[model samples]
Target: MNKTNSFRKTIIIASLIFGMLFGAGNLIFPVHLGQLAGKNWLAASSGFLISSGLLPLMALIAISITHSHGIFELAKPIGKKYALIFLVLTHATLGPLFATPRTATVPYTIGIAPLLPGNMQKVGLLIFSAIFFGIVFFLSATEAKITDLIGKILNPVFLLLLFLIFFLAFSNPMGAAKDAAFTASYAHNAFTNGFLEGYNTMDCLAALAFGITVITSICSLGFKREKDVAITTVKSGMFGIFAIAIIYVCLIWLGATSLHDFKLSSNGGTALAQISHHYLGTAGDALIAALTTITCITTVMGLVVAFAQDFHKRFPKISYKTFLAINCLLSFIIANMGLDTIISWSTPVLMLLYPLAISLVILGILSPLYKNDPVVYKITTALTLIPALFDMINTLPEVLRSTPLIQAILSYAERYLPMFHLGFSWLTFSLAGLIIGLIIHFVKQFNYSAVED
Candidate 1:
């Protein structure tokens, strides 16, 4: 019972968690928030932090606390078959469908797109990703020092360069904040926009998948006990939030200031690149590109490694090498898809998957506190998932609303739920409904399960 061990473990685990949470997408969301939030930066930042800062970190803490092996374990309390469905959906989300594809797309947009022609952009993405995952496969092949290279050296370097941009922005504001895009609804809308922007970050959902890797990394540093791992992850994760929040605040500020000088760019990368060009001159854009490419590469490496590791576990007969090859190939195909298409197509899937992902994250950290109750997990998941469906349908207004089944669900949600038009209102209702459902579900269970037969 060395209390000191827990403290030491927390620092180690958190440093590792920080590395996981801070990645390529961090560069994207804050800039957009700053642009759209314009004069309403604080209100928008509030919403941004809830989804970007607090929710994902909460989810990570939950994952470590519950000892979920993957997304599947957190969902397993509902039923094995249902958990499998959740597993496939979560895997597809972080894999080729959205997140994995974005790794290739975002870097190209920020790092290469401005330099290339419209027709050449897709070719650039395909080529960059091919090389990107190839390097990931090579680095992941060895489990020893290279992981440190990525988790430690390369990542810190990425943060440092980004921090320099933040520092410059801080010393000199880029421009004045403009009127927010939807000013009439800006106050309430900020939160919903923040929630959706959080999706673009994609780390929270990825956190669930990477949660166990974090636990193992903690144990490897020599904190073996489960209690120690929990304490360590929570503490370390808090430290990470502090560091990331600083960067987020800086980027948002940069975005807000830019409106003083120019109309907001249609794409977020444009806003970010503009900031770089103004502050540092011609070379700064290239400097930003170099850092971004590095960030994207490291993330792809980590994700592919995590995915391969999980696949091998499910099929023990297949060696890790084989799984690694399979992962790289799948990622390569998915990456070749044009950048604009990935960004456009990902919205529906991201909306559909987020609440479910959010639920797993919350359930994991809270599980240890709850004695891993199957009834509690089952009830809460069911409650949370209902609104996520609506969120998904609403993302595709023309296609989804036009469909019969979706029209039915959209009708039901709109008719019954107030503020349904507000972005992510469904997330709020579903989470609220879950809390309420759990209270009733657990009390009923206590009466029936706890009463002596």
Candidate 2:
């Protein structure tokens, strides 16, 4: 392709990536982080960007470098059984269990729920989600032009609307971000809190799930060589993630500054609603509603389609449409639990899955060094698994967490694990695992070479 054509194609791919990754959590979490981090928003944003922005970009690059077809293949070095388990868990989290459901509830929470009478909020969510998923099901079942639909059309509109909000917020300030008071959680370890908060975006997880589609999209654009595809993937992914990072910074800033006029919100969704209304009044509410709905629909459609297609491939006996129906129905049911409940429940799952996902991304990227050895993958994953389980147990619901068994386990972890209170006890374990795995792989390699000589 010529320079102009290549640039155009890169822009198109970048838009597709941005649309796929920038969904419910992407919109909400950073804003909430800003509210909590307050004067520490800049420091918090650095950690948030590392997890949410940098990790996702690395994941895409990892997928391209490994030349894996999907998450299953990206994880295959860990062994087939482990790969299958990881696949199921990853998809389940991204599908009906959390992300897909959040798509419906987030838009409802930010848009429609506020409009309804207090008692009517429950029924309103029910009606709105039903309608929302109905549309998702129909579009996914039909296998519509989802890429073009989102990239060429909806994403641009969403960005325009979002930037308008940003423009207004900056032009007519709610308050200065530096002067905003820090919340209790952020008062101590704001960066760590922000790092943990980035898990809410789930973009790292989504990058693995969505990586193949992005590669395939690049291939379809006439990039025949693997080298060319990887290069384009990096180029396009950088553009996309850079855009997302900017938005995250803006949203976090918005959250911090809004503290001048409003108290800290329960969640980012509420903060966003308040900010939008503050800037634009009733029209702002409508603008936010439209923006969220557009973004959410694009997201849910991608999730449902991905789930059905992946599951149908795994079980040929079941049809894609049947899986599609199952996903939408389940998501609709879960979404009615309300946004806060969904977020609360998702924390434990993300806690468990993120270490695995991050390790996998790192492993894939470094596979070239280890020559894709299974022993390394196995040992690293096994050690990481122990700390991940502990993290999940620690983050469980208050009732379950307060139980004797759970409390005892948590107490042990806190005493023994570094950074236990900071929600990153997994970092030390994961690093140790990686180093030990590499040492084992090299020792085995040295022994074999010596014997051969």
Candidate 3:
């Protein structure tokens, strides 16, 4: 009886963690991708999965493997100051500089925008957001009894609402798919675009940040062992992703089918909300709006907690309460800008961050395989950053472009790397770095002396 109860409890804990990772952005983006990708949804989705699914799961695995404080501490092999820079960069990626504010704006766009009178929509958004962020401020200000209950209840309610919504879309698709937006290049181009798109979802970054929380939750339930904790986290992640996978397929297909009736949407958010309002009617729009807001709030809360926790670690003098207050104020401000803009700027940041993120996971996985050597971390990270920097530069606006270095690197990447012409521009360049590092590691190892000879 005792053993059976323990196993059941473990399952529940695992499921909740999975749910936490699968929130607002997760729902919004993939469905939108489906609409654009159409019959090509599968290929595009596979691209989405690389960042959305694989990269994040791997980040958690890296956390478990290192059992370190965060990405900053984990990268101590490099040096402390360098690690802090990585930490600041990651927090900025997830928070005020980009994603954090978007969290607030996204739900507003999806949930509230449709119901308003055409001329009043913008005004309604501004008013609605002020109230929304105020609530975030209050709930975040003090983790009260009500907040705990609300958090627990959100998962089940959100799931129920989503299940109901998707059911409607699947049983009665808006219409058949119209035409692929970028057909010839859609399949191959998808992975890179998907990779870039993954940033907007923000899970890969969140995975590293939230890994400790997952481990702690598992431990609270009386389990220990980093390896076991990691296994559990991965298992839960897979379960959540099971939901993500199904949802993405249906939503993208819905988006594609929507096109026969509607023109090509500017992007996913428009396509999703427009399709929902069209098929599901006024009530459906309201339901989506409410649900999107709920999901986004929870994610925003998670990021808040993470930021506060980091601050507490570095400055013990300032209590968690102080940090929470500060975070809420900042997030409230960021959230007001609206979701559309937040997502726009996140792309270039992803080009900068994704390679380093992939590097951490790859390095962590290969750490044991290589005996956690200083040289491997140093060399591989250096090589990986080169192309990542190049890719970031290649992706920027012309006036925003710095010097000729970016142009020089882009020309070189095109010449040497595979798929460069096809638009795996980012990953192709990274591959060049990966290859160079591996070759150097092998060649250098053999030259080391086995004896004093």
lDDT of each prediction vs. the true structure?
0.72, 0.89, 0.68
- What are the per-residue Cα lDDT tens digits for candidate 1 across 161-220? 887887787788755555444345555577666666777777777777776566667767
Stretches of model 2 off by over 4 angstroms after superposition: 142-144
TM-score of 2: 0.97
Clashes of each: 6, 0, 5
Q: Rank the candidates by lDDT, best first.
A: 2, 1, 3
TM-score of each: 0.89, 0.97, 0.87
Model 3: colliding residue pairs: 34-252, 35-252, 35-255, 35-256, 111-289
* Top-lDDT structure, candidate number: 2
Better of 2 and 3 by lDDT: 2
In what order do the candidates fall by TM-score, top score first? 2, 1, 3
Predicted candidate 3 versus true structure: per-residue lDDT over 14-88, tens digit per residue: 455555566677777876676556667667767787778777878877777777656776677767777788877
Q: After superposition, how far is residue 405 of candidate 3 from its true place, in Å?
A: 8.9
Candidate 1, superposed: residue stretches over 4 Å from native: 1-12, 178-188, 365-370, 397-412, 425-453
lDDT of 3 at 33: 74
Tally clashes: model 3. Answer: 5
